[model samples]
Target: MSEENTPTSKSTDINERHRVRMERKKEIVDDKIQQAQRKAGVIVITTGNGKGKSSSGFGMVIRAMGNDMKVGVVQFIKGAMSTGEEKFLHRFPDEVSIHAMGEGYTWNTQNRERDMEKAEAAWAKSKEYLSDPSIGLVLLDELNIALKYHYLDVHKVIADLQARPPMQHVVITGRGALPELIAVADTVTEMQEVKHAFKSGIGAQAGVEW
Candidate 1:
């Protein structure tokens, strides 16, 4: 074969091009990182039809705890059943405060008035955490579901969230997050349902789905 068209030469050329591309990408990423000098806390929203929204929020709770920060969690529509995150985070009484206030899902409860009452109670607890500067991060788990059902007023929630401590972060998780919440959030992640194991024959497993 000719030297110009050799397989080894082509491989080397491709590798060199990849290296150059990655180097440029690294520089751009590094520049962005350096340019981000703001130290204020952020609002993060995890929503959509897929699962893992509350899981992601709890992961941040653990992350914040790892940094020696206090966290408060209010589970809006999950008090009927215990969860792994709740069980685990409850172990840290000083670092974490968890309130699972909901009676259950709306369908199971079948009472709008009761659901609204529970939601209001949960919101009151969440607001306490939001106002506390000592609480570094607040997780409003499954709050979007309550908002979607109109158990709580979206505008009031948004206004209270806006008034939270400047350096206290917040995470709201559930399917169908409101556009108003998304607009004000610094980070918004939507977990789209591509496929689910439960749709097959598998049931909700321990540690994974709980």
Candidate 2:
């Protein structure tokens, strides 16, 4: 075979082409990173039919805590049962403030008045965190569910969220995030459910669900 068609030569050519491609990709990525220079806290909404809304929100809380930032969390429609995140976060009382105010999910509670009262109470607690400049991240876990059910006024919620300290981040997690909330959110993530273990006759296991 000719030298140009030899295996070593072909390999070198392939590597050269790949290197050029990656270099071009790197430039585009770097430019985008350069454009993202503003350093302000943001409103992040994680909503969908899939799992991980609360899980993802808690992940941010953990990330913030790792950076030595104080975190405050309020869970709506999920206080009826003990969750892994709640148990773990409770250990660090000084760095984290977590409150589970809901008695249970709406369908299980079946009491609109009680659910509404719980939601209002939870929002009141969340506002305390939002107003505090010391709290770097505030996680309003499952707040979207309450907003969807109209347990709390969406406008009032937005106003409180908007009025938070300019450098404090907020995360709202649940399904059916309202359009108004989405409109004001700095980042909106909608998890798409493809396959679920629950659909395959698997019960919720600790550390995976709840």
Candidate 3:
């Protein structure tokens, strides 16, 4: 072949190799995508003494909803009062179902009986959502704290959740997560407090906290 033809042939060979490599990469990606679609969802547990546990769970809810999955969230320690999460997530009322315990935190309530009652009510509602197959993701916000504070029966909660529909996803968040809860969870994340401004006497800013 002539010099010009030789260069053209080499360029064509390179292009062909690049095209084949891209095609193989695409097939690999397609196979992984199919695998993800076929596998069932699993439980997620987020627990720690640091802040934003619920926030992280809710962020996952948003991701699930974006994929057209139905999500339910039950706030045990956080009451019916307003928060930034409620404000934004409220926009997707149909896609998201949120049930807030009427009674707030233990210290906030200062009434053990009332707190227990509210936690029980919230647990009942959470149980109902957990059993529903249509609920692709369930966020049990502050559930660990409820268990730690003896606001709800931990065994009962575990039993009910253990009987949840297959393929359903559950996320429990709060400090002092129980061992049983951790055992059944497929993914557990502990948000350690490495350094936080709260220890420096800094008040929680709006939108960041609450």
Relative to the true structure, candidate 2 reaches a TM of 0.96
lDDT of each: 0.93, 0.94, 0.86
Q: Give the poorly placed runs of model 1, Cα more than 4 Å off.
A: 4-8
What lDDT tens digits, residue by residue, belong to model 2 across residues 107-192? Answer: 99899998999899898899899999999999999999999999999999999998999999999999999999999999999999
lDDT of 1 by residue, 9-69 (tens): 9999999999999999999999999999899889999999998898999999989999999
**Against the hidden reference, what TM-scores do the models get?**
0.94, 0.96, 0.80
By TM-score, the candidates rank as 2, 1, 3
Please provide, for model 3 over 65-135, each residue's C-alpha lDDT reduced to its tens digit, 9 standing for 90 to 100.
98999999999887756888988888988999989887656777688888888888888899889889999
Residue 68, candidate 2: Cα error in Å is 0.9
Candidate 2 achieves a global lDDT of: 0.94
Whole-model lDDT, model 3: 0.86
After superposition on all CA atoms, how large is the RMSD of candidate 1? 1.4
